[model samples]
Target: MTLAKGCTLCYQGAKMVLFVTGRCRRSCWYCPLSSERKGKDVVFANERRIEAPEEAVSLAERMSALGTGITGGEPLLCIDRVNEYSKALKDHFGKEHHIHLYTAQAPTKPELEQLAGLVDEIRLHPPRECWDHITDTDYIASAKNAKEMGFDIGIEVPALPGLELLIPALPYLDFLNINELEWGETNAGEMRERGHELADGVHNAVSGARDWADELLNHGKVHWCASSFKDSVQLRERLKRIAENTARPFDEVTDDGTIVYGVLDLHPGTRDAVVARCRTFLTEDEFSDCGDRVETAWWLLEEYRDRIPGKKSVVERYPDGGMVVEVTPL
Candidate 1:
C-alpha cells in the first residue's frame, strides 16, 4: 500500500507514540498540547501517564507496535532520557523495530551521532520564522549532518502560509510532512490572536489550513496530512489494532474501533444474586466480572434486561484505552 512518505509505520497502525517530555526551548504560539501536558515535564505513552520505561514497552506490546515515534516539547533536550528509552525499546523489541524522533532543536554533530545509533528516522521541526527561508537557518546544517550520518532525515511543519519557502531544503531531506494546523483548548486564544478561525463545522482545525498543503504539492517528497485523516483514519486504525488484541471476548469491536458491550451495575445488597442469575443465562466465555459491574454481549443483555435486577446500559468505549465514547439505556 502507498502510505505517506516517512509516515509508513503510522499509516499501518504499527507505530506506538512515546511522549518523552514536554519541556522545550522555544515557545510556539500554535502549539496544541493540552493544559495538563503543555509545559509540564511529564512522560506519556499514548494517553497513559508513565513513570518507567517498562510501561512504554508494555504499551507497545499491548498494541503489537512494529515501531515507535518519540515526540515531545523537544526530544533533544533530554538526550540522555531519549537514549535510555530508545535503547530500552530496541533491546526489548529488537533492532528491527523502527524508531523515529521529532525535535525542534538543531542538534550538534555529536548529538546527532548518538541519536542516530538508536533511531531509524529523524524529523526536524524548524521554528515557524524559518519557514520563509529555511535554507538560511541553522536547520540546514543539522539536516545535512543527519543525512550524512545515514538517518532518514526529514522536515515536518504545520501547514501555514509562506511554507513553500521550505522547498529549497528538499534536496537535503528525504521527505517533508505538512501537518494541517489545528486549534486546541490550550492554543485557541493564541490561534485566534493570529487571525485564524475554525473551519465551518470543524472542531479543532483552522480555516484555510488545507490550502497551504495544496500550494506545496508540486514540490517532490511533500506529504500533506489532513486533519480529518488523523481523526478518521490514523487514530481509528490504531484503535482497531489495539482492540483486536485487548478486547474481552464479551465485547464487540465496532467498525470505528470502539468497544461495544453491556454493563449491569450491581449494588452491594444484590451483587451476588444478580451475578449468579446472570451466569446461568450467559456462557462463561460470553460474560466477565468487571469489579463494579458485569460486562456481556450487548444483544444478550438487551434480551435479558427486564429479568436482570440492576440498572442496565450498553456502553461504547475507545478500544486502545477504556475511555467511554457513548452509553445508552435499554
Candidate 2:
C-alpha cells in the first residue's frame, strides 16, 4: 500500500529514514529519544530498526514504500553513512523516490556541496531548547546554505512556548515544521518536572505544546506541524491502512510502552497436547479451525503459555520449530 501524500514524512512507506547513528551534539531535557543515541548503534526508525540498505529496501518492498527519509542523532554526524544511505537509495529506488534529511549540524559549503547530489531535501534542526549552545546565525546560515546547495531547505523543531523569542531569527528558512513536544523514553522526568502534564485522555504528551502550535498557526508566522497528534490519531483510523500496508504483520506500540497485538501459535497436535494440558481456557474459545494459519481464536490459548511459538516463525516456519510473534506497532 502506498503511503498517503498527507503525511509529510513516510507518506509513501519510505523506510528510507536512516538513523545513521545515535550520537547527538545536544541533550534537550524534553528529548524523546533520551540518551539512546550517545555512541549507540541504533538506526531507529518509527519503532523500527534500519540496519542495512538491503534490509531497508526489503522492508519497503513489503510495505510498498515510495520514498525514504534519513534523520538521526544528526545525519551529518555520520556523513559517510549519510552518503552511503543517500547514494544507495537514489541508486536503488531512482532519484524520483523523494529523499529528505534532518540535521542539527551546520554543514560547510564543501559538506553541503558533497550532499547536494545525494539528498533531495535538508531539514535543518537548530533546536530552540539550547539557545545558549548553538547560534542564530548558524541556523539561518545552514538553512540559507542548504537552499543554495540544491536541497529543499526547511527548519524542524519542537514548538516550545519559549520559542516565541526565537522564531523571527529564522526568517531565511523556507518552512518551519514545528512538532508538538511529547514525553517519551528520552525525557519522562524532565518533562514532568517542567510541569508538562497530560492533556486529559492524551498519554505522555503535554497540552502546552498544542497551545503553542495553535498560536503559531493563528499568527501564520511559520508552517508548523502538530505531528504527534496526527500520529496518535493514525493509530486507530488507519488500522486497515496499517494491516493493508504491512508487508509482514506487526503490532503497534503505544506511548505507555504497551504492545497492542499479541499472538502465539503452536504446531501439530497442540490440539491434543495443548488441549490435554490446557487448564484455564476452553478449547472451543481457543480454536474454531486451527490449521497452519493462526486465527484470533487461537490467540485465546491460555494454556502452554510458555511453550507457544512466536507468530512470525510459525508463519515463515523457521527451522527452530516454534513461531515467534512480535508485539510492536509503529
Candidate 3:
C-alpha cells in the first residue's frame, strides 16, 4: 500500500510533522530543522502547507494521510492551530482517523483535556542531555495524563551516541522511538558547531544514532525501532493506514522532477500528454521542475513508452512529469 517516497500519506513518503513554530523554549544542538524555520508557524509539512483548515482537511485526505503527526518548534505554542487542524481532519475524515502529535511542553489539565478529543497519540522529544533531568515523576506524570485521556503516548529522540547510561530506566516510558540522527543542509552549521559528522553511507542511519538504537533495543524495556526499520514496518504500516483511511490516486514524481508511467521515457515526447495530465490532476496552471517557464517547449519530454511485441509493461509516471513502465518481452 506504500505509494512511493515523498508521496503524501505514504510512510517515508510524507511524515510531515508540521514544525509549526520554530520558536522553542529550549535550544538543542542536534536540532536538525535548523534556526531559519523556527517560530514561523506559517504551517509546513515536508516543505508544503495546506493552509486553511478547510483546505488542510481535504488536502490531507487527497494525500491519503493515515495520521497527521502534528509537531512544531513546540506544538504546545500553537496548540490552538494544531487543534483546529486536527479536529477539522477528523471532521472531514472520521474518528478512526489516526492523529498524532509531538511536543516537549507538558500541557496543563485544561490543554490535555482539550487535546484528548482530537489527537490519537503523542510523542515527546526530551533532549538527550535532559534525559536525566526527566524522571518517573515528571515523565510518568505527563504520560499518565495523556494516557488517561486515552492517548497512546510515547517518547522519541535522536539516538545520540553515548546515551546508553540512561537505557536501563525504560519502565519510565511505555514506548521509546529512536531516530537515527542525521545532518541535513538546514542544520549543517549547527551540527558542525556541535562536532557532529555525517556518515559515509545513509543506510548506516547517522553515525552514532545507530549505535544507540542497537544498545536500547537489547534491553527490551521499550520498542526501539531503528532507522533501517524493515520496509514492511517503515513504509507499509503507515501507508496502508493512510490508504485505508483516505482515497486519492497517487502521481509520484522522481528526484529529477519528472513523472513516469509505463516506461514511456516521455523525456523526448510532445509536452501535450504531460501538460494534459498535470492540468487534469495536479492543476490547470502549468508547472515545470526544470525552472523553465510553462510555455518553454525546448524541455518538452523527448521520451516515450517503448512498445515491444508479445510483452507487457507496468506503467509508472515519474515526479518530473515523465513516464516509466516495467515490462518483459516474451
Candidate that would win on lDDT: 1
Candidate 1 residues lying further than 4 Å off, grouped into runs, are: 1-6
Model 3 lDDT, full chain set: 0.55
Each model's lDDT: 0.86, 0.56, 0.55
For residue 142, what is the lDDT in candidate 3? 80
lDDT of 1 at 229: 79
Taking all chains together, each candidate's TM-score versus the true structure is: 0.96, 0.69, 0.66
Q: In candidate 3, what are the lDDT values of residues 237-272, reduced to their tens digit?
A: 434334444421233333433333221223435445
- Tens digit of per-residue lDDT, candidate 1, span 52-171: 889999998988988899999888889998999899999999988899999998878999878877998888999878777788888889989888888888889998888878888989
* Cα lDDT tens digits for candidate 2, 1-330: 121132344432333345677777777666676465654757753445667767665544543445667776767778888888678767877877677777877677888888888877777777565544434557667767777766777666786876555556545655656777776866768777888776656565567776666645644436555555455553323322333444222333334222233334546755455434433343443432344434332234333346544442212211111123343311
Off by over 4 Å in 3: 1-16, 34-36, 165-169, 201-205, 219-258, 261-330
Ranking of all predicted structures according to lDDT, beginning with the best and ending with the worst:
1, 2, 3
List residue ranges in candidate 2 displaced over 4 A: 1-16, 34-39, 129-136, 219-221, 233-242, 245-330
Of the two candidates 1 and 2, the one with more favorable lDDT, higher being better, is: 1
